[model samples]
Each structure stands twice: as structure tokens, then as C-alpha cells.
Target: MIRETYVLVERELKKWVGRRGTFFISLITPIAWLALFGKSLNFVNMFSSAGLQGANPVIVKQYVDQTLLRLFGTTNYFAYLATGMFVVFAFFQSVFGGVNIVFEKRLGSMNRLRMTPAPRSSIFLAKMAATLVRTFFYETILLVIAVALGFSVDWNAINFIEAGAAIALLAAGFISIFEAIGFAVDNQEIMFSIVNLINLPLMFASPALFPLQQMPWWLRDIARFNPLTYAVDIVRYNLLGVHSFNILEDWAILIAITAVFVTAGLLASLRVLENY
Candidate 1:
């Protein structure tokens, strides 16, 4: 099964790499958010322009920086937002992980794949592995861009690995769910509709774009139930020293939820594939 999964994953990655246009185009959205939107939300600059320039500029800067520190755990809002975007970029890629499966199914490749001796579970595992590889590649590029745009982080190796692992698991969880959806559905449009419906709401509802404390109570309640909220907390704590939840608790819940998602999604996809 491991060998079969490896070959299948290689095929998927090779196919993905061949599509140069799509890979580069997929990068534009996160770059825009990190470069333009990330820097634009700086509270220090906002307060500076809001007539606080008349006061001793140093005092005003200190005041705004301190307030931002309290609100975001760092005075550099771009760093806060960039870490969030790291998880979010993985998110967007993971959400689309099953897109190729949908296409393969439609083009008769899925049925062909089932004719092989490879276990149905390997089929799912290969797709998940391949998507994670692709996601991590893009994440590396995005991180480089973030660094160039004034996003700072602890210069520590453990922090880098932990943040990467947190994102990989989070991406795996989402990829499993979407991969099951790909196997279960016949039409590509249904997969797209589901992605569109949940993607933005998930991003907005979590601390991905704003602090959870800044949100209304009802919204905060909803975010508490979101796996993304935990994922972001884990990433932020390791990468930026900014977090809302206990690091250990966040890891526990994230692992529990991701375990459930992976189990359910694999079983469901295998069931659907068996029927075909």
C-alpha cells in the first residue's frame, strides 16, 4: 500500500507541477492579502493619521504601539495578519485538494484507478499526501514573501517546524473532508458550491482576519467551535508569540478534531468508491 500510494502521489504531484499557469495564478490572491491588505490594517499608522500627529510624535507612537500590543499581542499588525494568512493559504489549497479527484472522476480516470489492485484507502491517502506536498511548497513561497514585507518572527528552528506541522495537520483535516466530498459527488459544481459557501465564512469567523476578542460575543461563540480558530492559535503562538488559547489545549483539540475528520473522510470516500 505504501508503494502504491507513493507512485500515485508522484503522479499527482507531477501533474500539478506541469500546470505552471494555475500554480502561479493561485499565488496572486495570498500575495495581495499579505502585501496590500496585511499592511493596510496597521493601527499605528491609522492613529497617526487620525490627528494624533499633533501630540509628541514619539508619545503618540508609543501609545498606539502599546494599545496594539494589548490588542494583538504585537505592535506589528502585519506580522499578526501574515501568520494568519499562512494558515489561510494552506486552507485555500486544502479546500481544493479534491478538485482533481472530481475531474478524474468525470473523465473516467477514477473508474480506471479502481481497476488496479491498490486498496481504496491508498487512493485517498495518495491524494492527501500529494496535496500536502503541494500546499507546503506554496506555504514556503508565501512565507518568503511575508518576510520581505516586514513580517517578523522568532529566529528559532523549533518555531518553524511547529508552525509547519500545525499547518500540515490543519490542511490534512480539510483535505480529507474535501476529498470525501469529491468521491461522494458526481458534479464538479456541487464541490465548488460547497467550497464557496464555507470558505469565506470560515476565514472571517475565526481570528484569521481579526482578533477573537474584537468580535461580538455571538460570533466569538461560533469561532470557539471552529477548528480553524484552534489551528490559527497554534500557528500564531509558535510563529508570532501571539495566541488566544492555551497552546497545549489548542493542540489537544486540533488533534482530536483532525483525527475524527481523517477517520470519517477516509471511510466515507472508500465507501463511495466501492460503489462505483
Candidate 2:
């Protein structure tokens, strides 16, 4: 199984490397967010320009700190925003896990592989592993861009290790969910449609680009149940020295969610393969 999974991982990586343009384009979303949106997000400026008519500077300062900085735990909004981009990049990579399988099916590659002695589980594992590796590659690039744009991330070895683990687990869980969706649907268009339906809502509802406290009451309630919210909090706590939620509790929830999705994804992949 290890050998078979490794082979699949290699194949996936090769495909990613060959499509350099696609890989880079996928990365542009996070970079653009940090470069353009992060630097420009300022409610204070907007409020001031709206002419509150000589409001006390101290009151304005306090409002900014409490409303925005409190949510992010940072004066530098870029750092806060960049940290959330990890999940965004992870989601992008994971969303395509099963799409690869669909393409292989169309190309008859999957049929050829099933003719071999390779276990069906191995095929799915290989794709999962490949997605993980791909995510890491894109995430690293995004981090470099963030740092270049003056986003501060914690570099303490212990913190970095813990944060990396959290990221891996988050990616694993999301990848499994998407992979399951891909396997269950034969048509790539339908799979992508389902993905699109869920992706943007999940991103907006989570405290990724915006803080939870600033959202409407209903959106905040919805965010409470979003796994990406937990992912963002865990990563921010570890990497940005921000602890909006209990770190230990967040990790527990994230792990539990990952386990459920991974199990479902494995079962779905196996069932799909049996049919193929």
C-alpha cells in the first residue's frame, strides 16, 4: 500500500509541476487578498470620511481596537488576514482531490489502474496524500508572499510545529470531504457546481477575511458551526499569537471533524471504485 500510494503521489505531483500556470494561478487568490484587500481594509478611514463631525480621536481609536483588533488580536490587519489565507489555499487544493479521479476516469487511467493488484484504498490515499503535498507547496508560497508584504508570523519552533500539525489536520479533513463529493458524482461539472455552491459561503461565513464579531447575528451563528472557523482560530492562535477561542478545545473539535470526514471519504472512494 505504501508503494502504491507513493507512486500515485508521484504521479499527482508530476501533474501539478507540469501545469505550472495553473499552480501559480491557484496561488494568486491568497496573494491578491493579502496585497490588495488586507492593506486596504479600514473601517476607521471610511467612518472618518463619512463626516462624524469632530468625534473624539480617543473614542475612534478605542472603537477600532475593540471592533477590529480584538477580533484579529493584531494591530497589523495584514498579518491577521494572511494567516487566514492558509485555509483558503488548503481549500483550493482539497476541492480538486476527487476531480483528479474524475479526469482519470474519463481518460481511462483509472480503468488501467484497477486492472493491477493495487487496493482501491491505496488509490484514494494516494490522492489524499498528493493533495496534502500540493497544499503545503502552495501554502509555503503564500506565506512567503505574506512575509514579503510585511505580515508577521510566529517563528518559534514549538509554535511552528504545533501550527503545522493543525494545518495538516485541517487540510486532511477538508480534502476528504471534497474527495468524497468527487467520487460520488460522475460528472466533473456537477461536482464543481456542488463545490462552488459550498465554497464561497463557507469562506464568507467563516472568520477568514472578516472577524466574527463584526458579522450579522445570523452569520455569526452560522459561523459557529463552520469547521473553517475552527481552522482559522487554531492557526491564528498558534501562528499569530491570537487566541479568540480556547486552543485546546478548537484542536479537539477540528480533529473530531477531520476523523468523521476522512472515514466517510474513504468509504465513498472505495464504493465508487467498486462500481468503476
Summarize candidate 1's per-residue lDDT along 69-121 as a digit string, tens digits: 99899888888889899999999999777777889989998888999999999
TM-score of each prediction: 0.97, 0.91
lDDT of 1: 0.90
Runs with alpha carbons beyond 4 Å of true place in candidate 1 = none
Candidate 1's TM-score: 0.97
Instruction: Find the 10 residues in a row with the least total lDDT in model 1.
Output: 39-48
User: In candidate 2, what are the lDDT values of residues 1-276, reduced to their tens digit?
Assistant: 899888878987898899878886787777778888987877677667778548986787677777666666777777788878787678767887877777877788878988878788888898899888888878888888888888776588897777678788878987887777776777888887888898899989988887888899999999988888898888888888876678888988989988998998889878978987
lDDT of candidate model 2 versus the reference: 0.81
Rate residue 168 of model 2 by lDDT. 86
**How well does candidate 1 score on lDDT at residue 85?**
90
Give lDDT per model, in order.
0.90, 0.81
The parts of candidate 2 lying over 4 Å away from their true place are 42-44, 52-67
